[model samples]
Target: MKKAFFIVSVLFYVNSYSQSESKKAKILEMISLTGVDKIGVQMMDNIMNSFRNRDNSIPDDFWIEVKKEVNSEELINLYVPIYDKYYTEEDLENLVKFYKSPTGKKVTSIMPQMMNESMEIGKKWGQELAQKVIQKLENRK
Candidate 1:
């Protein structure tokens, strides 16, 4: 009986591990289909460009080497758990299907531009609100 229990436990552990790995792979596929991986790489490139702009002493070869060392998979792996926490396997599968469709492709293509414009608008709104707050505080004083 003890041996049978041990075998069952081992089988359960293996099955659970296999399911977890399968879920992780699905999450990765969804991320790739949505172009999030490319966005991460683009963000890295923008940060590197900022660093290069701030200090001209950094050699081009150094930046090149740094880029080579940077693995987008590591970033994607970080995303996997966060996605897994919020989305079920079925949700991820549906998302992957949507992202493969034409409408989804259009959305993926335009999202970065929309996000940038929204951020700019938000910044301007924030600055205006800050000015208003400052004026009100001065009047109160």
Candidate 2:
């Protein structure tokens, strides 16, 4: 009886691990299909370029090394668990299908620009709010 139970437990554990791995693979593929990793790389490059433009004190070689250290594969691995936390394999499969469609392609093409513009808007908004707060403080004093 003990031997039978141990065999069954081992088989169950293997099957469960296999399913989990399969789901993780599917989610990773879905993330790839959405062009998310490409966008992340582009964002990193843009930030590095902006920093280089603003500050000549930092050498180009240093930024190059930083980019190498924070490469896309590592970022993707860090991101996979977050996706898995929020989405099931079925959700990922649906997302993969949507991303493969024409509208999805359009969204992917435009998303980076949209994000950049949104960031600019947020920064401007925050600066204005900070100015207002400073003015209020000055008036109070």
Candidate 3:
């Protein structure tokens, strides 16, 4: 009888402890703990700002041409609502936590610039490789 009573008591304690947790709050806590969403948001902001600052290096007329070809406004109209479905309260919390971390801050600050620079280098190398391959083919012909 004492063993049975002790078993029941343990079960009750476990049930109560678990019952006290709110699923929504638990999910939010998990998202804040993960911190990936924050990094992604920071990256997107950096990339958007980078494009916005194109200066005369990329002619604004090209943008006007592109906008005329593809109505970016219409595309965004169909696209923007997905954020409500995909970016939850949990994700926002996680993003906030990541934005506050030292490594996360460093990545948010410089990674986009590094990526842009590397892409330019990759394009340069690809052009060189294509020229070499073309030369080789012409020599053999």
Candidate 4:
């Protein structure tokens, strides 16, 4: 609950500061600056596809388990620099624009909930497909 509220609060704050450019254009500029146009899309797509698994065999009590390993603030601090290196103001402006817009606002509002659903969907389908591929190879052998 607190996490979701914080995300929304930050999004709102960002949006309040940036609205001069269209979000799409800003996003495009970011892709260009990041030099990801060549195959970044494909790479990210592949990564997302790989996130799915059939058994949904994610760590049980995942949040609690993660909390046990390290403090959230410390973990966030570790990733901040890596993220900051890639995230330019233009990228942020675009994100803020999305966060402010009607569709973006709605998406952001449900972002966490949506991710949980997506993970389950991805895992269930992904595992099944992978299993079939393995079975096919075993049969051929």
The global C-alpha lDDT for each of the candidates, from Candidate 1 onward, is 0.93, 0.88, 0.61, 0.59
lDDT of 1: 0.93
TM-score for each of the candidates: 0.91, 0.74, 0.37, 0.42
RMSD of each: 1.4, 3.3, 11.8, 17.0
User: What ranking of all candidate models by TM-score puts the best one first?
Assistant: 1, 2, 4, 3
> lDDT-based ranking, best first?
1, 2, 3, 4
Residue 92, candidate 3: Cα error in Å is 5.1
- Model 2 residue runs over 4 Å out of place are 43-71
**Candidate 2 C-alpha error for residue 115, in Å:** 0.7
- Expressed as tens digits, the lDDT of each residue in 1-141 for candidate 3 is 999999999999988666434334444443344443354445555655578696648876765564456443443334334533466555656665776689767766786689899999999999999999999999999
- Residues 1-141 of candidate 2 have per-residue lDDT tens digits of 999999999999999999889888987887787787787898899999999999999987899799888868878888888998999878888888888899888888888789989999999999999999999999998
Model 1 lDDT tens row, 58-139: 8899999999999998999899999999998889888888888998899898998999999999999999999999999999
Query: Which is superior by lDDT, 1 or 3?
Result: 1
Scored by TM-score, the top model is 1
* Residue 139 local lDDT, model 1: 100
What shift in Å separates residue 127 of candidate 2 from its native position after superposition? 1.5
lDDT of 4 by residue, 1-141 (tens): 999999999998888556423433455543444333534444444544455343356654653454366443443344445545676656667665666678765765576678789999999999999999999999998
Q: Where does candidate 4 stray beyond 4 Å?
A: 1-72
> For model 1, how big is the CA root-mean-square deviation?
1.4
